[model samples]
Target: MRKSSSLINIKEVLLSTRKVLNENAIIDSDLESDLLVAFALKITRAQLHANINSPISISEQKTIQNLVNRRIGHEPLAYILGVREFFGNLFRVNESVLIPRQETECLVESIINYLRHKSIESPKVLDVGCGSGVIGASILKYFPNIDLISIDISPNAAQIAYENILKITNNNNFHVLVGDLIESIKVQVDLIVANLPYIPTKRIPTLQKEIFLYEPKTALDGGTKGVEIISRLIEQSTKILKPDGAIFLEIDPDQKYILKNKIQHLFPKHKIKVLHDLSGQERVLSITIL
Candidate 1:
């Protein structure tokens, strides 16, 4: 067999990949290039660095180029890579489900802290609009004793969530269902946690191309006011939430006051607190039933 002149070493390929990504105005081009190349080679980023001078065959170079082109076209890297890291665990992601965001981790932390403070043994939890099952799966991974039910309107999203929950926690205490918010839930739960659609319809177009063009609109549009679906969930939660149960929701920073008022009108005696993400943005809304 003759070696091809077009063959290149990993260092050369990486430099070229990084240059292409940079030229395309991709954020974190250096990091993305590393990830893309590593993914193409079926190796970890660390491993890629370890074998930096390794030679790349023509086929591997083509694969890397294909992935780079997809990203340059505004396809989300997570979708291209087939997984996303959320709360320290890698969950498979596709256009069917929303990619988990780092800010949403605040919601998860809030729920975990509350559960710890309450010291509830085997708390019954419900995760509404459980896309990719990141929130519910992270919770279950941390607290395996809790019984959780995750619901999504899309069957495909539900399946992805099911797989993630099973893969992440390996616990049978969770159920992933395809249904509207709590509509199919028959029993009351000790807590409800969700990171539902909260971006207003008009604002959808203003989102980054990676989100607006590639991600599912159904998972991004929260109707006109950005609270339509979330409001509905709050309304339905009243019927299935225990008296002392708590609800933790990820919301737009501007939505805190409006959502708080809504919660007040519905559960006047309950406690309402807005939790901030690392950036000091009003992110999570905590509503506790009295």
Candidate 2:
């Protein structure tokens, strides 16, 4: 909170940001400081380093301070930056969609790895609850020839998803639908990927402020049991999925056992594989029709 003259240099601005965020009890203050500084400077992280000693203009310093204020107000860093990196690519994001998380990358990777050896060509892929189109767009980026269809119930989210997909891959092979899960898909796909709302109604209040306060509630609430949307997807997949098609679901670590049981009771013949993320937390459930 010093005069703009004293906070002119990149280092000074970064230090100020860290101080303010730390005072606000923000976790990852260091990384958030760096991101806010780089974003305000309109430079990459490496560029920000290169200009460490360079002077920040009065306007840029004010911009950085404003960004810091937003973070202090519990706004997510991604929303402040207007983009989030997922699967090694940056996708545009806003309050309309749930910010993409690193754990979701596992879902994309699993699908890519599975398809690498399979004979399926132009596999039909559906991304249910495709917020910001990260999952579908990333999949199509890796497998350009596959037919990709992504749907989200939120129109705001659907628009952003469309923009992201078109931004990443200029190809016309992907389709974006703005509707509920299976209702939006008319064709059966070889694979379906979803990162639907899994947070239980009771637990939503306990979520971090960066999430419950800033992110869209529709994208996080999963009704009373938390498995409502996932359960519906399981039932609907039976109608659209090919005989050997698979569904890869990104879920909260604690929901694995109950989800497994739900899937088992619904589809008794399918094989369910629960996959852990890098932290070894149960993250993805790969269900294949046997």
Candidate 3:
């Protein structure tokens, strides 16, 4: 015997929602389906499917329609689902920060590999401009002993990062600061990792609406050349990092050559390496203090 439900049909809603999403150019129909249903149920995607046939309550139906309308209007999937996966971990996210991109995971891997080769004493890590704490949290997850400090300029992003921290480790080893990159931290660090905004101000407006309109500009604007934050961080990092410490960052492919030249000019003896991403794009730019 089935219960008579006031709620709309689950399968019907998913079919209609999938069509709506595809119309908006969302190619991953499966992900779109899961996200909408998850939002409607106020449950994890896994849970949503686990009880797929279960009749939805009336209130859930209302919530589903509202969320689907928002998603159809071009809101990001991360913003709709309220989560993002990065570096093999799930982190809370919202419109407050730039969604974690797979490209940045290469930056984290480079640091891990470099540490393995150098056999350095467990290094203390600092992740400046850590939007969702993904970079810092991933580092912590891999090397639990690495002391970490992460910061974001937006308080909302910082709050999201803090929530993520609470979900991960219990040790107070990780510090989440809210402000410009290095201004809030007092302790010296052994490794500096940042994926700061590198999109030039002039180009931001030309980007797709999902980025230009939905995402916060503070996390995207990089001034005239998209090097403003990186340049400042490089100068300040030199003073705080241990002479033997290293720094790694995710950079736009076109900007790598200029950054490499700048590092060579300012610190002639130090060595710099431009790592390439999966697509062979120049991605993680690493600097070793000699």
List model 3 lDDT by residue over 216-273, tens digit each: 8998998899988998888788678887788898999888877877777766678888
Report residue 181 deviation for candidate 1 (angstroms).
0.6
Worst 10 residues of 3 by lDDT: 1-10
* Winning model by lDDT: 1
lDDT by residue (tens digit), candidate 2, 184-262: 5778789989999998999999999999899999999998979899889888888899988899999988888888887
Q: What is each predicted model's overall lDDT from 0 to 1?
A: 0.93, 0.89, 0.82
Query: 40, model 2: CA deviation in Å?
Result: 1.5
Once fitted onto the true fold, the runs of candidate 2 whose alpha carbons sit more than 4 angstroms away are 1-7
Candidate 3: clashing pairs of residues: none
Q: What TM-score does prediction 3 earn?
A: 0.91
Which candidate leads the pack in TM-score? 1
In model 2, residue pairs whose N, Cα or C atoms come closer than 3 Å (at least 3 residues apart or on different chains), thus clashing, are none
What is the lDDT, from 0 to 100, of the residue 186 in candidate 1?
A: 89
RMSD (Cα, Å) of candidate 2? 2.6
Q: Residue 262 of candidate 1: its Cα lDDT?
A: 88
